[model samples]
Target: MAASKIAIYGAIGANVAIAVTKFVVAGITGSSAMLSEGIHSAVDTFNGVLLLVGIRLSQRPATAEHPFGHGKELYFWSLIVAVLIFGLGGGVSFYEGIQHIRHPEPMRDATWNYVVLGLAALFEGTSFFIALREFRREARGRPFWQALDQSKDPTTYTVLAEDSAALAGLGVAALGIWASHRFDMPALDGAASVVIGLLLAGVAVLLISQARGLLIGEGIRPETARAIRSLAMQQPSVQDVGRVLSMYIGANEVLAIVDVNFKDGTATGEAADAIAAIEQQVRARFPMIRRLFIEASEAPVDAAATA
Candidate 1:
């Protein structure tokens, strides 16, 4: 299976189990943080399902109305996931925390909370480790942060980010429960929920920014763009290379347009041959470039016009 699918499946299984256990434990122990964690897990489970749906829809063939295929469906669903995280996970947690703060109550039988928390951590941690490994595989030689910025597949990175936050939230919940009992201050539990809410909001904002960029047709990496321009400039009949426009149509698919000016008195036949050779060479060099359009011009094309 694809990395995205693997990450989503692992997360869905872990979250569904964790959410059920946490909700039951929350009801038994009446721990605000536990309840918040349950809500978070539930939302994550639904998000995973949505991501799978996105993957399916994104695979649909291009239609007359949409020549570019349904690849952007993945971005659209990812944006929805971010909004749901902010609204359902973050908003609910904040509200619950405030309510608990205004009317604090002593947690009953905290032992069960600890047990459930420990088990939840185990499951969540496993899923997080899987996501991290998949992300590392995608990163390869690049630094993790740089790879994340360059990544076109939103599903994998979104899962990694969510899992990272989930692990952090679990730690906060454990601390809050311990401190509330150790210090005889019940307010700490609510504070933990608020902290978890803030963490989720931060993740959501980051995801929204990434999804928006993808939806708006983010260009290829600068290095890739430069390489493409160089490929065009290397053509024998080309006098000068003009604007080279490149955009990612999908994770592994790129669309590039090369504008070139031929040398003075270059025959039409020679220009055509050069254009074909350039196209073939570019595609051969970068297999990800699925579509290449070469335009022969008498004069160097305007950069501003291309932009």
Candidate 2:
């Protein structure tokens, strides 16, 4: 139902079909690149399943032992998926490529390779477009790289990256197959596999970095923090707002803690009322902030200025 689910399901379905076809063709034609592509697809299939599991686990309600809920489960699983992509998908592909290079086999008729690759391109392209569409909708006109950098949802982007790499790898495999047969040199097939491996490794590294940041605790945007501080300062009973600390506890949920210094002569009841008003305003503007705590304090103006 969700956009992320749609992209991930589409990818899994396409990869399952393509992987099976690729392995069959690889066995028939002995193309190293085909086998590598099959391995890549298989890894993607498993990764999709893991992401779904993460989504389910992340929805669990908060418990006494884990007051923040299981929101971080998704980040943990996403990190695991990145590691698997690097180890099984990238490492195995590289090793297979090196072996193929070391022991070159006689080239066979590549007509079937062409057929399978063309079909794979079609399937991968369809999945890629689906993911790209969802990402664009989420970006809302933000530049691609900038939106991707600021994105908190991992499912949509992870699927997009995997599909992008699949499309690129298919192109490389096709080119390598064509060149090896045309030039009577089979080593090019192995070279293509190596390139695919490197591509997967690079994507895996980027995903790992993002997952690590989320799992540890990534905060809301600086602009959003500043806006919240301004809201607090607008309250008549408030002197200043200080140390507006915030972190994303889930893809669409944030936990924020704000330190506020009330007016010098404000009554306790009035300060409490102001705190309630500030919380209401912040939450109204930013529904993603599921949990907000405002602490009354006597903080320095300089400190209050820095959200």
Candidate 3:
């Protein structure tokens, strides 16, 4: 199966288990942080399912109403997931935290909180490890931040981000629990919930920013664009390669528009042949390019060289 799917499934399973355990413990101990953690895990679980559904929807073939295929479906759903995280997870946690702070309740049976948190940490840590390893494999030799920025496939990155946030939130929750128990300040538990909510909100904002770029048709990497331009210039009858615009239509799928300056006074038949040759070479060289549109024009400088 796809790496994204595997990661999603793993996260869903781990989060579901964690969420159930956390809710049970929260009910038993009345720890505000535990309840917040439960909500966070539940949101992560639902987000995983949404991502899977988005992937499936994105695989649909092109139709008259949507000629670019359903590839953008994934981006749309990803945005929705971000909104949900912010609205449902972060917003609710913040409200609960404030309520707890105003009317602080004594935490009972604190031992169960530790047991549940330890188990949750184990499960969240495993999921995070899987996501990090998969992301590392994808990054190859590129810097982790660079690879993350350039990745057109949002699945792995989204999962990685979610799991990373989960681990961090778990730490905060643990710390809050410990502080409250040691200092006999139950308000610390509520403060920890507030922190978790803020953390989730930050993650949601990052996801929204990434998804917005994808939705607005972000261009291909500079290196890939340059390679495509070089490929176009290799055509026999081509005089210069002009602007070559490209955008990702799906994970590993690109649509390119090549503007070419043909040799002056070239015959129509020869230009046609050159265009065909350019298309063939481009598709052959970059299989990820699902569609190519070549336009032959009059005198024009190579935009790439000037840039």
Supply every candidate's count of residue pairs whose N, Cα or C atoms clash at under 3 angstroms.
Answer: 0, 0, 0
How much does candidate 3 score in TM-score? Answer: 0.91
Candidate 3's displacement at residue 160, Å, is 0.5
Superposed Cα deviation of residue 12, candidate 3 (Å): 0.6
User: How would the candidate models be sorted by TM-score, starting from the highest?
Assistant: 2, 1, 3
Q: Compute the lDDT for candidate 2.
A: 0.89
lDDT of 3 by residue, 1-307 (tens): 1888888999999999999999999999999999999999999999999999999999999999989898888888889889988988898888888888888888887899989889988998899888878878877789989888888788888888889988898899999999888989999999999999999999999999989988898877778778878887887778888877887778778888988888876667667777888888888877778888988777433544555
Which is the leading candidate under TM-score? 2
lDDT of 1 by residue, 1-307 (tens): 2887998999999999999999999999889999999999999999999999999998899999989788878889999999999999999998898888888989887898899889988998999889878888877789988888778888998898888889899999999999988888888899999998988998999999988888888877778878877887887778888877877777667788888888876766667778888888888988878878888778443445555
TM-score of 2: 0.93
Error of 3 at 58 (Å): 0.7
For each candidate in the order shown, give its overall lDDT on alpha carbons. Answer: 0.87, 0.89, 0.87
Worst 10 residues of 2 by lDDT: 298-307
lDDT of 1 at 229: 76
Per-candidate TM equals 0.93, 0.93, 0.91
Q: How many residue pairs clash in model 1?
A: 0
